[model samples]
Target: MRKNPERRASLLDAAIEVLAREGMRGLTFRAVDTEAGVPGGTASNYFANRDALLTQIGHRFYERLEPNAALIAQAQEGPRDRAKVVALMHELVERVSSFRSGYLALIELRLEATRRPELRRLLTERIRADVDANIDFHLASGLPGDRTTVVQLVLSLNWLILERLTLPDVFPEEQVHDLVTDLVERALP
Candidate 1:
């Protein structure tokens, strides 16, 4: 039988917790099953294999960010002399804080993926997609994209800085909004 959406989210939640508490070294189909209160092999049914499971976790990270992305798109689409990019970021910080337990698991996955080409591609794409979205936003903001090098540097900083932000997902949205926007505008041409 197909798992309900609630059950599926529960599985992912279990995977994140188990991976966080136990690290990649300890996560397994059985452990995820136990943590999620699903029967053994249930994880395998959804994830197919360990690699697939890890990959899904990475994908989930991006999915979690979609709300933030949508907000950014809307803000940019609206009228503003300044891009107000941080507005989007602040909204994202607020949204992510609730479902914020997955960062550690994702970081562990990145480390594990470094030695595994397949896994590396999964997380790498997540970063790339983030950058791509940022680039789209920057471009839509009417910024000059003449310097690819500078654009990349700023994009990298944005993602890494947000990643370092606390998870349970507490963050001062207003402070972060002001701080990040100042940093971006200062860095801009």
Candidate 2:
């Protein structure tokens, strides 16, 4: 395997696109190399095997999904009220809409994990860490929810919204907003 960070990142991004556009079956090293506009063997050089490539794609999805610093700062600086929470939820929805492809790839990763024990373990750990971090953030921000409530709310709402967003015509835009608002109101104090 080669050690080119930039190339590796580009190939992973290409992998995401391939996964999104064609699902798991289409995510081959040659496909990634073609998508990345690199040499035929470039992706194989960076990724030892399909499992390694898929794992990296899962990692890249989260890495690309780190919350925007400016948005986080804005949320932190402002009052931590229901309004702020609703706005944050809307922001999250907008983010999901914008990165529909990445989210689709993430969904594919989750399904693929179900049949692979190692990937399943890795994804489970990653998800738990994410939930823990979200819980901590909510507590630190003085959000009105217990850890369990927050965890359930975040996981449920996020997946619902993501599924709807990636698969168009599932829910109307206004309905999505209204549903999210209703959920937030109930989730928060």
Candidate 3:
């Protein structure tokens, strides 16, 4: 397989767009090549197979969604209180929702995972690690929450993002902010 990091990243990004726009059923090497604006067989050179592409996409989703260094620094500056946690939750929602296509593709991949056991295992492991990291971070940061609080916020906020993406009318922007505040306030000590 080709080992060009930049090319591989581009192909994976194109795959994400294809998955979001076309869903799992429409995702293919040809579709990714077209999305990436590369010539035929380009994506095939980078990925071994559909499962490999899907697994890479699962990893890439988290890579794209991770907070930047500046945001982490800013978060660390503030007092670790319930209000800070609320701000963090708000930031989290905004950050994840900002990458609209990535999150949408993740949803599609999740549904597809139900049929593919390998994909199911990959997503489960990655998501579990992410959840664990969040719990550990919350505990170490002295954030006004326990493991349950972090879990609740993660679960609730993910659905909130889904709602915001799939059904924008259900909760307007301002209402979502208010809801985040309410969720954090109620979840924390």
Candidate 4:
């Protein structure tokens, strides 16, 4: 039978919150129950096991990126101008900076995915699709090439930005903005 969407969604939301606060070990059923304000068995009823619950968390992690995908695709199709492409990348970079929890969840997923092939495959596919989408967008925008390397470059830049945020020093947002802007001209242009 289909699980109640509200309950399922609530549990997923709670899982992310718990994951950020406590890492994967923090996702005890009791913690999720309290976080969701649901009955003790509510999450278990849907997931039936810990792996199921964790997989759902990974799915939620990817879902948060979906809206931005369309915006990027639109930017790709709408303009060949370098300024527009760079602007879209700026918005994307800014969004990533603001949405720290999702990034943390992704870091956790990477650590956990080694033992969970399903998650590894799911994340792999999601990344491939994102890269494909971005490439298509760039192609439509009149980028004659840059098929394989853009994904690697974009993700590398993302990791660099995240790492910078973890530094003891001030975030240096302007530096990152300038850096990403330069990357846009070099990579997406």
Candidate 5:
């Protein structure tokens, strides 16, 4: 196994692109290598098998989508009111939506997880932890509403992101910002 962290990261990122473009069935080592412009078998060296590749891609998806600390801090510094919650939600939508490939790949992983129990368990655990963290962050920030508010926002916002990425025609581009605002306004106290 190769110990080049940079190369491994690149292979994983390439795998993400393959997943986003070709879906789960297209995620092969050769496909990843071609996507990454690395020599054939490069991805195989980095990942043991299809499942290993999928699992690593799952982790990479979150790594690529992690929120910006500075943005979080700035949002937190503001008054912790309904408006603040709305702002945070807006930021969250913008951040997640910006990583189009990462989000799309995540959707693929989720679907694939249905048939693979290990993958399903991994996703379930990670998603639950993320939800819990969001709830905790919202409460500690003195944001309006409660756990339900956070959960509702998470659910609605994810669907919004899916619609935005997979079916832009479903909602006009300009309406997205307003929709996020409306979701927050309606979800929060």
Candidate 6:
């Protein structure tokens, strides 16, 4: 009911922390309030319900996770060969690795969405747009993959690599790099 942007952002950040640490089952407004060190009911004041909080969390996740302008510019300047694509993949994996908790929270939100049709539809549209953007980026950068192949590679390999890197010692960095390289090479023209 109140219009406090900073407070809202803090609540969302706390929600992400709660989601990452306690999973969706633990993502109550009270949990977020505790995580944010705010008084009880603080999160609920900002978000009307769990669905609203989860939706905002999903939106904020993408806002925080999308590649920045500088990164995009750097990618644009680089050679658009297989090596560059592999390098980009490495960058992506490294970014996810660095933000492991945030990404894990995202994964939890995704899983939670499956049970809610409205949430599922919203997230599906957002993910599709993200994939479309990736496909366009690849084409603009002169990478050698058709839209279908790029879509598949992005959705499948990104999930696999993210899941692998999130868990303990599932795969080494070199192995991930090699795997991404192989995938990119296969997808390339």
Candidate with best TM-score:
3
TM-score against truth, every candidate: 0.72, 0.93, 0.97, 0.83, 0.96, 0.90
Taking the tens digit of each residue's C-alpha lDDT, what string does model 2 give over 135-189?
8988898866679867767776877677586665677666888877877888775
What is candidate 1's TM-score against the reference? 0.72
Cα RMSD for candidates in order = 4.3, 1.4, 0.9, 2.7, 1.0, 1.8
Q: After superposing candidate 5, which stretches have Cα over 4 Å from the reference?
A: none
**What residue pairs clash in candidate 5, if any at all?**
none
Best-performing candidate as measured by lDDT: 3
Return the lDDT, model 4, position 124: 80
Q: Between prediction 1 and prediction 3, which has the larger TM-score?
A: 3
Q: How accurate locally, in lDDT, is each candidate?
A: 0.67, 0.84, 0.93, 0.73, 0.89, 0.81
| Residue-level lDDT for 102 in candidate 2 | 88
- How well is each residue in 80-141 modelled by candidate 5, as lDDT tens digits? 88888877788888888888998999999999999999899888988898999999988888
lDDT of 3: 0.93
lDDT of 1 at 22: 94
> Which order, best to worst by TM-score?
3, 5, 2, 6, 4, 1
Candidate 4 Cα lDDT to native: 0.73
Clash pairs detected, candidate 2 = none
Q: In model 1, what is the error at residue 33, expressed in angstroms? A: 1.4
Candidate 6 local Cα displacement, residue 99, angstroms: 1.6
Q: How accurate is candidate 1 locally (lDDT)?
A: 0.67
Task: Give one digit per residue, the lDDT tens place, for model 3 in 1-189.
Answer: 999988999999999999999998899999999999999999888888999999999999999888788987877886889889999999999999999999999999899999999999999999999999999988988888799999999999999999999999999887999999999988875
As for lDDT, the candidate ahead, 3 or 6, is 3
